[model samples]
Target: MRSGVSRRTFLASAAAGAGALAGLLPRPLRAQDKTVKIGFLAPLTGPVAAWGKPGLDGCQIWAEWINAGGGINIGGEPHRVEFVAYDDEDDPAKARTGATQLIRENDVKFVMMLGGNSWPGVQPVAERTGMLFSTLLPSDLSPSTATLIAPAEVHPIYNVTAVDWLAANRPELKTAVICAQDDALGLPSVATYLAAFEAAGIEMLDEPLLFDPATTDFAPVVTRMLSKKPQIVCLDTCYSDYVHPICEQLFQQGFKGQILSCTLDFYDQVIAKTSAEFMEGTLFQFPDFDDPALNADFINFQKPNEFFAEYNRRHPGQWGAVSWEYASVMDLWKAAVEKAGSAEPDAVKAAMTEGGEGLHAFGKARWWGKDLFGIDNALVGNWPVVAIEGGKARIKEFRSIPDWYDKHGELMKKHMAAYNQMWDQRG
Candidate 1:
């Protein structure tokens, strides 16, 4: 909002919080030597920690960048950002404790979560305090939540883009199989893939495969999928920790077929377990940060090009679901804070949903998803269909999600009903 702060420049600098962010508090709001703090509530010690910690590191980079650039200008005064962190460990009870700790003890204004089960626990605390809460999981959105947003992703909705691409490109694959953990994120993905695969005209050769995270042997799981003889297999919202073992078994069984997933993080490990040839042609939603299409079409990142170079440099082979996602949310937050000229949660929420096109981490997009999620919190736009070629992953196209929603609205609702996870019940 200030002459010195370009939207692009502000987003880029505030994305990673590379500095301590302790010096970025608004001078007027500063209580003596104290600083402004934002809370990063994530699973830092559970099975999901790998997903949470990397994004926090990115947030650290963003805070540092903003603070270094003379901080954010609010009403002609400068404010630095300080990130206060708490580990929810992907558990409900711990998340509530962390939420209270950050709000009551630390007095943070904004709270970011890796979301999922952890979100349910912290939602009340966020509402009571009127603090801005961000979740990478759009399933966390609802009318009841006046302060929550899924600024970066609509995980399963984007996964449909891959299925759409595959349906048009690989018509020979007429049937498929699916496997997913029986959790919050997993259930919706199962419903989504069922709708996607069906809309693609791919028949299900077998019933959906459900795996327990505690289960150690995936050879049996792969054996079951092989028995169905599906031309394709869907890894519906699986954890990275599970993807390797499942893909390993798929390789050991030598089942060559089309594969789809919501993510393929640390897929290099998957390539090693399988062969480069076997891993090739796999489809997913996420993309490599350096994808050329992003540079040409998007203005959502701090510096998409430079950020990619630095991220890969600092933490090689580790980008996944929440890697740049949380930081991207921070960028949107900065824009909204500027638009509203305040950090109040209600003001930010109203600004986000004022009904025009909004800028998300992925280029400029429309704020949509009320029909699907019971709230318009997801930033809908062109999502990449990433595929593995000769073991190297690359984006093949940026497909429009709006068109697909137009065609398959009823089918998706049916799938959601089957899973008892209509947007109203996402919590």
Candidate 2:
């Protein structure tokens, strides 16, 4: 990747530019005196808050940018964007209630979700109301859920790209062991990692060490995983809550090998807890937006470096995997609403998937996943394989998730079925 401007320099320039623009135009431009509400329903105050709260923070930034820029144009009119947020705490009952309130009371046109434990509760609401919903987890998609779409962040499936990169670059680290908190998020990820490892010709030292989500002490879990002496320790889609303690355990125990995970959210904290040298070369699927690679031509995010700088300035030490994901979904939704000339959920959904393709964060992607998800709802494309170099998360490469599936999809399906994670099995 080409070297980019420093964050401090970039932010300084951005601030100057904004100040210059403000003099030329009215602040908080409202072009048409209209407003559109979007719903952010997810776990914002529990163990999963890392994913939910940071994403909402990013959405606030997105809304400010859009509203200040004269809002989204639908046909010939501009509509200021507003987000209605609800904290589900990853609880099903709360999620159901929150979804209803967002749709019925708040009159939100679109709802975005983290989509794991809370998805079941919102699925029925979507079906009943015909309200379009977006999920980070395409694993939540099925034939019965016509209103739900996975427009961004195809989780677990994207985990395969990191393993693929590892197997090619770190071939010496062959044997691996995996572990995850046994939950909606962890089970599917465990299966995906198993499939990815198998396809890479890496032997799993043992079956995935599933643990209770309630378990706080990770010392024993890390000890059992390290007992086999595997070169790679895979932390399957564990929440940031679980990943932090487990990584600390790995560092304390002094196992020098490759570390892989679906996400290394708040990794700076991890490095601080351990050591910069200890976290070096660790691989995962999400990159810090300030990574120079995000400035590449094909990347669909808007001014990622600026966004990253602004996010840090406003909410320091809070950026995580989902920080930009919800904003990314809003980008797609805005484009679709403009294309369809309406903010109606069905119209926007149809327009978003009009050509069976979408502009994913990394690049252009296909509306795939019928064979696996029982619906062509997921926008699958290249996903970044991130590694910690010099104590900073950087994008190593963008690996094609669909390409890997084309070659080893059956193996993945087999593993998903074994874990009862396949769409049919889920129902």
Candidate 3:
């Protein structure tokens, strides 16, 4: 775009013959170009890195595609987008430090995070600076947090769709047990599942099991859960770390019941640990990109199958829960920036929520969740109910999240209140 001339060299040339060159060059070419810095603050290392790093990898591919297509056009000038990532290690202290550094040092206009455990660390910075940010978790949403939005995967809440689908399709499974590691991510999810199960008329075999994050052996947990002899097992949004061991335990303990989870990341490994037969009919929320349903008209992600293949190629055996989520947010942000004619945070934020409608990768979703999470920042639309049929992940159905919420909003609020998760109650 600089015509092979360095900025300094171009400035020198312009100064010497400004009028002649300016008259000949196109207006866009004559304007000074820029590389817009977008900060990526997530765990690229440490225990929860699988959930963080793969999304960053997908973002790299998104950046490449945008740049190759001549970058994002803002105010008639093409500006290349560059991502500056910080490894927060999924730690609160490190997340705060990373947020401060990205804001003060990198001067990024937007910051994307994996959210959940790390959200509290960056909350202050986001409030103080009014910096626009995107999170995967809508539980992180609150009225006071004006600049943050969840335009991609709406976690836990969408988990309701999976439960709803299972209840409709597999009505014979009447009793269930739910379990999660007791933390920000797990607690909200546990509450959501509790509400979903109640709405579907599924009886709880016991109170939802809570475990420490440092938990290693899941034999005891599985043993206790199986003692109840639940017709269904709900792994209520456990991290991929816990999902594996808990699933393996279920197999080893020889408990045969419907297994449900908020996610089944790298499920092939789970199948390997247990068996293809064992994983059959296992239900969860997230979908594999190669699924035929992704070709639907409402799906906005560009070349999802290609993206998934390339991600696997570059980071073998590493793709997990968040592999496509952060990149999906990038797509929304880029569109907002172009529409607003500036990359400034406030302008883009306004543009993104202009009509309370967003092009969520799944489809056109509305900015909902104010009544539930105290903010209408999460993009709510249809979500896929994924099932492992014959050891392959397949879309059982695409359920309308808003439709479900309309009927069961009260149930969700009740459970969220019971968990003391309603924004105003977080004291």
Model 2 agreement with the true structure over 228-320: per-residue lDDT tens digits: 999999998877777888899999998899888887877887898999999999999878888999999998886788777766776676566
Pairwise lDDT winner, candidates 1 and 2: 2
lDDT of 3 by residue, 57-122 (tens): 556666655665567778877776788999998887899999999999999999988788899888
Name the runs in model 3 displaced over 4 angstroms.
Answer: 1-32
- RMSD for all candidates, in order, please: 6.9, 5.7, 9.7
Off by over 4 Å in 2: 1-32
In model 3, which residue pairs have backbone atoms overlapping below 3 Å?
A: none
| lDDT for position 333 in model 1 | 77
Candidate 1 lDDT (Cα, 0 to 1): 0.74
Candidate 1, residues 1-427: lDDT per residue as tens digits? Answer: 1111111111122244223223444233443333457898987665666656656666778877766655665455567778898989888789999989998898887888878888888878877877778877787777777677777777777878899999888888898999988888798889888888889998998889888766767889889988988899888888766677788888888888887878887788788767889988998887766667667746566455566667667665555544666666776776677677776678777777678568766677888888987777778887888998878778898888878989998888899888877767654
| Whole-model alpha-carbon lDDT for candidate 3 | 0.80
Worst 10 residues of 3 by lDDT: 9-18
